[model samples]
Target chain A: MTDQLSLTLAALADPTRRAMLLRLAAGTATVNELGAPFTLSQPAISKHIKVLERAGLISRGRLAQTRPCRLEPGKLLELNDFMDHFRVVTEQQMDQLETYLSELQAKGTEK
Target chain B: MTPAPLTVSRVFKAPIALVWAVHTDPKHQAKWLSPDNPEGYLSKLDFRVGGTHHYGAPGPDGAIMYGTQTFREIVPMKKVVLVQSFADKDGNIAPHPMAPTWPREILSTTDYEDLGNGTTRMAVTWVPFNATTVEEATFEGARAGMQGGWDHQFGQIEAYLAGL
Candidate 1:
């Protein structure tokens, strides 16, 4: 089985799924409501929802006869954490490079 | 459809020659390439077109992860373009250890612009290389989420989540 991180990334690999998440970010919506913006069938939308749900990116709740899907921020937080590492790394590299260059220049001046 | 390539840029207070040399030199690359840890080392670096660069370090749970970059173009002191891939210790192409669906290869270009007065502007751009429809969509989605429109939506999501 793929790990949670991999599953989350795979769930987010689709434009339709991402669009659905964007809509949910504003507010919760039913399967029909989520499917309204796209030319997808109910079953197709449901499949995408299942993928998101399995990745723990969205949660479905029952409301009378309809099921509304809400975005779960926790999974996204994990993704943010993963991406932030790269950002930090890049910043650190740039800083180190600056220092390295300064030291190189200092040596040249001393020679 | 192909999406806009992800790009990041920075300006360094150094001459174009110095900046370019630091970037191309393996010794300097080893100092700054890995984001999380400096202990990870580059095993091989062939600084020429048609050559390959390999680096790896111990990953979570005792698994050593490897990265390979096959150089396609090298314009000294100006640009370097390469195809990046995950690889095994033997340097054979492999799926990314964490995200298997991640693009098998990414085309990366690094450009250096002379800013005069001993300063240089560097920009790095990345895009999926000959990706499938699904891979292309995935790359586009990830890039958007990280650096484009989805970035604003993410902020909204963060605020909404905080309210919950």
Candidate 2:
């Protein structure tokens, strides 16, 4: 079975779906409401919603009138946690290593 | 089946000796380990087979999360194999504070090659060490999901979208 994180990232790679998730993050939205911001058709919006639902980024409620899509904060937070660690590995460390290595090279030239 | 190890490589304009020295030296390590926050991320290394480099990395929540890297093999400037894990201040292996499901020990190999042009190519290959199925899956997902610059945009969009 495919993991949830990989699915979430793939679902997020699309700008339209990212916008849809952003809208849902504010609050739950119906399919029509989600597609209102973009010029996509109902089927197209439904397709994106299906991807988000399958990825567990959003959940569809069985409300009688409209099945609203609510953001699943858990998966998104997991991605965020990964990003935080990624930042430490990148911003806090490797860039500095590069600079230090270059400085050592320069110092060796001066010696 | 074993998944392919995640490898990250970089080539530096310095010689292999300097590159290897920086990798093994504690003083040099403390300098760049957290270049912006010297006092935040602490580094103390005992470089030898089975020796450990215990350090604290600043967490996202403003806490210092400690980690330890134990040397499994040190082949001088050619290669160094280490087991990396989260740890307590005393350097005992521990679960990650925020991500407990993350691999407890990651075996990594760092190889330094002299390109004969006064440049050194360093490659670090990482794999989960003695990890559970879930832990291995976690590492695999993290490795694949994070291999992009889109992560930054995701953060920014999340911040604005979530109003956090």
Best by TM-score: 1
For every model in order, the TM-score on chain A comes to 0.81, 0.81
Q: What DockQ would you assign to candidate 1?
A: 0.37
* Candidate that scores best on lDDT: 1
What range of 10 consecutive residues in model 1 chain B has the weakest lDDT sum? B29-38
- Superposed by TM-score, candidate 1 places the C-alpha of residue A50 at a distance from the truth, in angstroms, of 5.9
Tens digits of per-residue lDDT, candidate 1, B38-115, equal 566556888789999887755434456688999999998889999998899988888755456667899999999999
Which whole-number lDDT from 0 to 100 does residue A92 have in model 1? Answer: 56
Q: Give the Å shift of residue B109 in candidate 1.
A: 1.0
Q: List the residue pairs that clash in candidate 2.
A: none
TM for every model, in the order presented, reads 0.79, 0.69
